[model samples]
Target chain A: TQLLEQSPQFLSIQEGENLTVYCNSSSVFSSLQWYRQEPGEGPVLLVTVVTGGEVKKLKRLTFQFGDARKDSSLHITAAQPGDTGLYLCAGAANTNAGKSTFGDGTTLTVKP
Target chain B: EPEVTQTPSHQVTQMGQEVILRCVPISNHLYFYWYRQILGQKVEFLVSFYNNEISEKSEIFDDQFSVERPDGSNFTLKIRSTKLEDSAMYFCASSDRDSPPEAFFGQGTRLTVV
Candidate 1:
């Protein structure tokens, strides 16, 4: 079973549209990270949020962690084709070896 | 910027054959990791190594799987017998700290078992 669940497994939108993707889990995590991956390449780290109820923004992309630390969301405003890629969320639990648990990922496609 | 480097961008091996994937993590990093991703699927964590020992492993990592840091800079993963299900892109990663720190990844080695 997947440790983390991501919503909207796939997304397709036009330029200038706004969209939000979600990651949820029943287990609380000490930290959560988001990454973006293009074709034929490894995932690139985007941001890491450690505190619950925390919100961070990278230009047009906004990330928020749930108050309970069991969920997170990524929101993009005025999306462009450059934003098209697979978005992944991974979490590290408070227990164990600090290895990450990853969600399936959300594939986004923005048509220009 | 420092980067993780993996060898053999792609490999084609027969089932029941042994294959070793090698990685050179960023210098001065304290932790090393191996992750895999099947086509059209999420990245799965396989194992994490620290202080010359395996600190964590996933259920997917079976007896046939083994990891080693033979030298100061190289981390290697060995599959004693490859299975059809083992076909995937294997990524090597490293981090400077153990506390969910920023992990840098290699381009990944695509393994094809037939």
Candidate 2:
């Protein structure tokens, strides 16, 4: 089974602090996606990186797919209280169906 | 903006009872999926459906679980017999043919099997 492991399961920081969450896997994937979920709600897609070494930015969040396609990372610059949520990373296989396998996720709490 | 929608935001069922979760994907989406997240755990894929048939499913999708489109607009997941461990938040998602991997998810149904 392909498994994605995320680091620093829980994080709490003052507003404006920067934080980075990492997702690593022994298996390679064709694409990777990041999502943010609010309490009691489904996850909302943040960004998708299909190419190795690819990087995408959405407002204060930056997502990077590793060069080997076996890992990815999310970095938040000057995180605000609004940025607090559970961040998840999912890897999609090369198959046409590409059912994604998700990581355990990192819960972030940014205090104002 | 178009989005997936699911009904019965929460459900409470007795163990061994059958339950069906409903979802309505985006009108133009061609790929549909069901996923579940146990409390404090990662989201796990259950099944993926395309062309009115199941394209792929995870080991978690056993004989006890089934999925059906039933109609052009509605997709459903049925649990034949619920167990205490079956309790979780079930999410329904969909994506277009243009980007079959980029899924848009619904608010989810929180199922509590007692």
Clashes of 1: 0
Lowest summed lDDT over 10 consecutive residues: which window, candidate 2 chain A? A91-100
Give the per-residue lDDT digits (tens) of candidate 1, residues B7-47.
99999999999999999999999899999999988899999
TM-score of 1: 0.97
DockQ for each model: 0.71, 0.64
Question: Tens digit of lDDT per residue, candidate 2, span A1-112?
Answer: 8899998899999999999999999999888889899999988989989889999998888899999999999999999999989999998887748488999999999999
DockQ top scorer: 1
Pairs with steric clashes in candidate 1: none
* CA lDDT, candidate 2, residue B55: 87
TM-score, candidate number 2: 0.97
Per-model TM-score (chain A alone): 0.96, 0.97
lDDT of 2 by residue, B72-91 (tens): 99999999999999999999
